[model samples]
Target: MTNPPYGTAPGGQWPPAGSPFTSPAAGPVSSQKQSRGPVIVSLIVAVLAIAVAIGAWFRTAHSDVTTQSTTAPQQFTTQQTSDANKALCDSYHKMFRSVNGAGGQTSDDPVLQQVYAINIRLATHVASDFMYDKLRENPAGSPQLASDLRDLANAYNEVLMAQLADAPKTELDPLYSNIDSADAKLVEACK
Candidate 1:
């Protein structure tokens, strides 16, 4: 006798007809093959991106070195040195004239006199610095002038500090003498 739902096949097999467990007379089923073209293209694109980044870095580094190598120190001619010296002397003379002019004269009021003195000292300091810079650019041309300007600047600084501290006249005398000596040397060097 046969079962009701799970009945025997025509040849009395266990499974029913047309089920997957029943193999066909031909053979087993075959699956489709996958392609590797897309994967290979992706790998090539990634390698190309890395190469481009490395090339750009090298190019930037080379350009920086080239730019740094091109710059050279300046060489001053005799005429240029003379012109620089004249300019320094002219600037010093202008500052000297301004300091001795009417605007720098002492007023009757003590406070006004103090202000004038401070202004004169500041002007002298600035002029000295300017002349020093000019000499520094071509120190070989006028070393003596450079030395004198340095001394003058130092003396004036001492005098300014003394005046600020209300030092006695005796204390200021030496500083003033030093300034005068440096000034005379500068004049001679300029000539």
Candidate 2:
């Protein structure tokens, strides 16, 4: 075959009039939209961090009022609980008998009303301080006994309050019956 012409190949021109080392001219662009996504994300993260820090500060600041009880409430043997029940019940029993014996029919009798209040105060003192207090310090072993004793103590206190308010003779029997029922429950629970 015959030799080809200068700066030309068999079917095309050579190099195409461009340098390989030169970069292409850049196109005009709008100023980069300050990506709002990152700014929003950063603000959200900051707010959440502040919220967590504030919650922790509040929890610590109020810790004194929320102080945990270190003392463990304790339970007792059946016999011990039974004894406690008996003590409270005995006070109620005595109060019932004494108030009944005081026996004033008229609600307007100031001396008798005063006597009722004094006896009620005494009975409340006995039940609350002597027996109920101990039971609270050491809970009953059996759930039934504990419930029964609580009922009795509450009933005893309620009766005392009623008597102090000079509940009528008509109200006396039912109040006494409540005490007896609670006491019987205590007896049955211990058994």
Worst 10 residues of 1 by lDDT: 60-69
Pairs with backbone N, CA or C atoms under 3 Å apart (clashes), candidate 2: none
True-structure RMSD, every candidate: 29.5, 28.7
Estimated TM-score per prediction?
0.51, 0.39
| Number of clashes recorded per candidate | 0, 0
Whole-model lDDT values for every prediction: 0.61, 0.54
lDDT of 1 by residue, 1-191 (tens): 45555566566764445566655453333346556655554565456546656744653332332242245634768887677677767766775676567345767865556455555655554554454455454443444554566677667677777876889999999988998898898778766
Q: Candidate 1, 16: how far from true, in Å?
A: 99
